[model samples]
Target chain A: MIEVRHLVKKYGNHTAVSDLSFDIDGGQVYGFLGPNGAGKSTTMNIITGCLAATSGEVRIGGYDIFEQPEKAKKLVGYLPEHPPLYLDMTAEEYLKFVAEAKGVKRSDMKRQIEYVIEVTRLQEMYKRQTKFLSKGYRQRVGVAQALLGEPELIILDEPTVGLDPRQIIEIRDLIKQLGKTHTVVLSSHILSEIRSVCTSAIIIAKGKMIANDTLENLENIYSGDSYVTLRVKASEIEIRRALAPMDAVMGVECTQLQDGVTEAKIDIDSDFRDKVPEQLFYAFASIDRPILHLAEEHATLEDVFLELTSQADISEESADDTEAKDGETV
Target chain B: MTAIFKRELSSYFKGFTGYVYIAFVLFFIGTYSATLNVRGTYPSFEYAIGNMSFIYIIVIPILTMRVFADEKRQKTDQLLYALPVSMGQVVVGKMLAVAVVMVVPAIVSCIYPPILGKFGSVNYASAYGSIIAFFFMGVALASIGVFLSTLTDSQAMSAGMCFLVLLVNYFQTTLVGFLPTSALASFLAITVVILILAVIVWYMTKNLLAAAIFAVVIGGANFIYYSVRPVKYGGLFPDIIGKLSMFSRFDTFIESAFDLTAILYYLTVTALFMFFTVQSLEKRRWS
Candidate 1:
């Protein structure tokens, strides 16, 4: 377990992280979701002891990070935004050196190194110098280094960046596998990546955590009213008149459709599907109109993410970002 | 500590810096030995060591510049910081590694006195004494270089700044004579020195109030001392500066005095700078 209480990191006049606190339990993968410069890396650095916190304490497996750093650090492994690697040394040699520095026993060292190499699939590149390796392989070596000593907690910062789609899937699978045995905490700006891998997520905008919950719970929390999309072989006025008469219906509006069939969206509270669909069916039948399509449009995770993160003063710098995400969510 | 020490030592030989540093030091040693001991027919190797002591001002920077600076520039210090080792252990390990690199060539230099004994009578005791003193003196100088390397991440800048400091320490005795040693002049000099120290303290702690209090206290104490005993300040500043010269202290061992005070001074410098190196590293994490 890792507990970060009121963590803060400041650089001169700029605040990197402010009054952030969260607890991470074991055996689950947690995602840190934020845009660029959102203090994800800073918080990870502080938790892993790479950077000192301005105020507050981090306890890893009940060991205070500042007071008993070696004990606390022994329980955690960290990979920063850039893999801290020695280009001059081969991957095998670097892993051995790190294993020794991490206080792995000489007897277990060989076995530990082999395990990480196999897990990261670096068996082919073990003898090659890190400088000659591709960026993806270098990142794998970085992950391999963190896996050494078998720390209880592994923290990765943007682990899938700069990788091809196939490599990204491979790493995502690896992270999911690691989560079954060890707690995994990863940060990325990719929403789908988090949705695919993370059991829970914490989303931050401008250094403040805006949401922290499961994807399903977050979708429900932001979803205020239910809307349904219905397609009927009827005129727009006919469909609107049928939906507007239902007692549970708040309003109805006709939206564009590709087929000759007309489409209208119905807004209502609770699950009025049973009564409303029957009422609409009878009303439309009496008017001799055929129903082609009827389905409830459930809110997606992207909708909740946009509605929450876009409320702050997004600058001209991020206007394009908003537009791009808006297109996908809509 | 052992892991870091082994890595540092291996890195020295992995690059040309270690071999070049040893070759440069030995080259100067060979030239100085021929001129002072062989051609001059001096029985004591101490004379040769004394004449060649200035070589450290150049070689020490080359040997120690990349020790911490390269780690920082490459961002490998993050690995060190994240490791389960204390900052003190890392500093001590690197210092010991550099000491090994320096002592290796000095060991080869150790065989010179016995070989010279074949041609003529040689003072073996004094030769060994000076060799030991030379080793400690170089260690002390290298510690200063290591501390300077911790202050910046640019290797060239670290080397340049370390070389400048060594130059000042080498010529401090001569430079001291140029300073006026009158009561008022000594008072002003001490005040300026104390204020500079306070500023450095402030830079380290970033506590302006504490630094201001310390400066006032030191300035007030010095002023009271000068007012009470005006004549005692005469020639004191120059005498103090001469005492602080790192190489000047080694002169006693070369003269065959076996001065334990100089040896103590060298050890003190080594300890003080090692402590400062640790502090510099710790401060980097906080800031």
Candidate 2:
């Protein structure tokens, strides 16, 4: 439903979004996962035709956003990071304006507005001025505005930033419901929100795409490297000595927790991660050290997000190194 | 476009801007019409409109300051940009809305000439002609104000800048008379104006090389023209400034010449500034 190719957006000397490319299919809730200043908003802006890419092509529903903006924009609804609400206007009036601006038929405008208001649960606040609405209600108004015209795709940028936990969940559930019928793309810095609500995730950092996959695939791919934390009734040296001879143990660090208890963090090789727990069990048994705690720590999406974004920085640094080397050669 | 026009128009009436602007303009119209036409027994209604032309310097700013600036400040410009409408449509719709708000007072003032005719002989042609000219000039000034509003996000800044621009245009003719009218003075003045234009270009495009090249080329060309024909530069600055003054063009109608060129000039300016406003909005997407 959406294709962003070689998109680059630069503000003077600083590139906000760099040569990023992605394709999103219809009817899936896609999460744009990135840290702050990671160009997620810039990419979203470009996709929704709210911004111009320095040099790139964006297409929505087979229509070029720049060349056929009206047609392309008709197929997409966008709620920017800041909910674009006129404080003086009532929610109903704002939605009416959006509906008209979207070219909703006069006959269907009322029904469409009411449907979105109902879905976003903004029926009661419909008569209130947007300024009087709280941040969460204002956000719902923004969402309702996007939901007008029944666009095929909805793009939201950090939709739940300031909302309380319950409001966030409501918005997420609303987005999930939207995903059943429409293509949804939401950008967020909060990992848990994306993991809970999004089916597919695209991770970007430093204006580059670091990872893109289904949530399950990303978890499975990142779950290969696991850590095992152990609390044993032995001295630090004995705990270390027990695991030192094991080749499957990539690295281990032990700390003395008390007179006879020691806490150890063991990094197991991917090939032996499943069996390493059993291996540690026998190793500690042979050493006459009683095992108090032994649990495998699986890598969650949060860990994957951190690893990928940080890896982006390391790769960027290496790229800088190569450029410096070339400069030195010249 | 109609949706935006209606929304903007209703907002003007709902808020203080529309009522205040209409009252302000009509108050002056009433005061001027009473003094110039009714009290002074002047037969011509154009004189009142001509006298009241200065109100635009204050009223246009108030009417147009929040049109685009408030949208940007509130971040509602994103909705406008993301909407299915083109920036041109949005801009024209807004300009039309302000024009409609301005027309309310113009329509009220339209009742003045025939009423003034009750007391004495009134040249209805010149009277209505100047009213038309006043409306055109006000719309033209409103367009310029809208363009200025797009240059900033703060309503205060937009209003201040708009007032400054209209004030300069309001007194442009008088300011030109202060110039020495010498070829050297004209050359220096034109260069300064070109430099300012170039700076604006740089500020918008953020391209230093382009601004420098533009400044040098325009400056060099102006110097070449001056050096080639020094006599042509004599009083040239003042003439250009006088022609550019929006208020000065209204005087021709008041003087009883229904100048088609002045009406065309107002329309051309209106179109030009509305086009610039659209470009300014589009440019933000790139920036």
Candidate 3:
């Protein structure tokens, strides 16, 4: 439904989005996953013909955004980071103007507007001016505006950023329902939000795509590395010495408390990750220390998100963004 | 285009802006018409419209201050950009809406002349002619106001800038008389304006080389023309200002002659500024 190729957006000397490319297929919920300042919004703006790329192309359906903007824009619906509501107008008035602007046929305009208002559950608030509505309802109005034309693609930027948890869930459910008929793409820094509706994600960091794959594929790629924790009745040095001879053990770290109860975490390489736990049992037994506790922890999607976004190679911006996100989540 | 035009027109009336603007213009025209035609017993209503021409200083700005500035501040401009409509259509649609708002007062001004016909003989041709010129003059200034509105997101700033622009035109002929009529003085004064133009170009494009080149080419051309025809340089600057003054053209209409060239000039100014407004709207896509 959308193709962005070699897109770059520069604000003076600063590059906001650099050589970013991605393909969005039809009929799936794709999460545009990124931390703040990850260029997700910039890319979306360019694709929707709201902003121009410095030196690349964005095509919607088959029309080039720069060359044939009217045609290209007709294929996509967009709700920018802010709701873009006219606070002076009631929600009903605002939607009617949007419907007219989108060139909805006179015959279908009523049915289409009704369908969106019902789906967004904006019936009660429609009569109220947007300025009187809460932030959550304002966002609903923004979404209803995007849904007016029944465009092929619906692109929303940080749609649930400030909503309450219940409201977030409602919007997510609405998005999932829309996914059944239309190609839906929404951006959010919250991992759980993305996990709620998306089967796949396109993760970007520092104006670059780091990972683009389904949830299962992304988590599976990093699943090979596992953490084995051991709480043993041994000195820290002895615990390390007992595991030092094993080739499958990538590294060992241990801390001793009180007289000599040691807590150790060992990193296991991919090849022997499954069997290394059993092998760890006998390795500590050889040292005459009965194993108190031994458990292997596989990498979850959260771990993969952190590790991928914080990869050392991505550069300066991601470091600050991932650090801020980490401070929030942890 | 029709969708945008209708929305823009209705939006003006939804608030106090439309009613206030219409009432405001009518308030002035009614006072002027009563004093000139009804109380003073003057057969000509052109003098009334001519006397109140100063109304545009406020009227144009009010009609245009929110044209694009409010959209930018509210971020509703994002909807405009993402919509499936060309920028030209958006600009033209908005201009048409503002023009329609101006039409209400012009149409009202037409009634004063015919109403005064009951009291005495009235020259219907000159009276109606002045109304036409008055309306076109407003439209020309409104186009400038629309372009200024596009430059900023602050409505106050946009309105102030537009006020200053029309204010300059309000006293255009007087300001021209203040200029020294010497050949060298005209040359220096014109070059100074060109230098300011160069500065504006540098600010817009951030290209010093391009601005410098433009300054050199245009300034050098003007200097060469002055050197070849030194006699023509005397009072040339004032003549240029007078000819370009939108308000000055209204003077010829008050003299009771329908100057077709003045109408054509108003149309050209309107067209030029409308084009500039479209270009200004298109400029955001690049930045």
Off by over 4 Å in 3: A226-297, A312-330, B194-217
Which is better, 1 or 2, measured by DockQ? Answer: 2
* Lowest-sum lDDT 10-residue window in model 2 chain A: A269-278
- Lowest lDDT 10-residue stretch of candidate 1 chain A: A311-320
Rank by DockQ (best first): 2, 1, 3
lDDT of 3: 0.89
Q: Taking the tens digit of each residue's C-alpha lDDT, what string does model 1 give over A1-330?
A: 988788888999888887887888888899998888988888888888878889988999999999999999999888887888988889998999999999999999999999999999999999999999988898899999999999999999999998999989988998998889899999999989998999888887777677877777887778766777778887787777766667878778886676657888888765564566677778788888888877876576677778877864365348769899999999
Indicate whether candidate 1 or candidate 2 has the larger lDDT: 2
- Pairs clashing within candidate 3: none
The DockQ figures for the candidates are: 0.66, 0.76, 0.65
**Model 1: how large is the Cα RMSD against the reference?**
6.0
- Steric clashes per prediction: 0, 0, 0
Candidate 2 per-residue lDDT over residues A225-249, each given as its tens digit:
6788999999877877888889888
Candidate 2 off by > 4 Å: A226-296, A328-330, B183-230
B1-287: candidate 2 lDDT, tens digit per residue: 99898889889988899999989999998999889877898978889889988999988898899999999999999999999999999988998889888888889988887888888988989888888898999999989989999999998999999899999998888898887888788888899999999999898888999999999999899989988999999888888888999888888998988999999999999999999999899898988
Task: Give the TM-score of each candidate.
Answer: 0.89, 0.88, 0.86
Interface quality of candidate 2 as DockQ: 0.76
